[model samples]
Target: MQANYVFRVTVQLDPPTAHLDPDRFETVCRLPAATPGTDGWLFFQYNLWRGDIADADHMQSLLMEKLGVEVIEASFSELETDSAYRAALESEIETDLSRFNADSVDAVVHQHLGSSIHVRDAEAIPDA
Candidate 1:
């Protein structure tokens, strides 16, 4: 039997700068997990920035509350069905990294399934 889950993560940038610094922004760390009676698992993607100056915890809390998403600390197992989804996520990370310059800025990518996942995090799929 397969299981599926969705991850909702909130990223907080430091200094609230005007431009994003790609070098300072490290790779996104994710904790994948599965839901009951599903075929795939959800993951958390986190981007770490240099120079601590913002409250990531506070920002995460606000985002989860505002978006009415369940936020928890857990691990997710990879699923074969998520191959395409992972590819799209990697592509977006590449794009964001490419756009990074020597500027202090912040951005967020909310990931989920279907409309729940932001386009920035998920790829565009046609109606099934």
Candidate 2:
């Protein structure tokens, strides 16, 4: 349940005079984990081109709506998950290997996530 896809976002003020410190700022967006074996799980493959955001206008619209600010840029960072989540995801993958067109769980994970999956110990995650 703690799994998520993290994005690094840059935002700008509508008016340059809005903030004296900086007109542009950096922020992070933690998208909830999409259930494995669902189309939502293909977010990286369908929504992103390369490691960057594929559709700038769409991303900007989404961020603007959520953050209530002008989104300057957004980039896919990584899929952060606990070991338990990873195990579950792998189990889900195993249930339908044909769906991924891959022989093994590792292949399916690599095909979708590439090197952007970060597995961490569940206990290491701090309470929010």
The clash count for each model shown is 12, 0
lDDT of 2 by residue, 9-112 (tens): 89887665564458788988877677666767666556665455677788778778977888888888877889877887889879988976789988877676
Candidate 2 lDDT score at position 4: 78
Cα deviation of 29, candidate 1, in Å: 17
lDDT of 1 at 118: 24
TM-score of each: 0.25, 0.72
Runs in model 2 lying further than 4 Å from the true structure: 15-21, 35-42, 48-56, 126-128
> Candidate 1 — which residues are off by over 4 angstroms?
1-56, 63-81, 100-128
lDDT of each: 0.33, 0.75
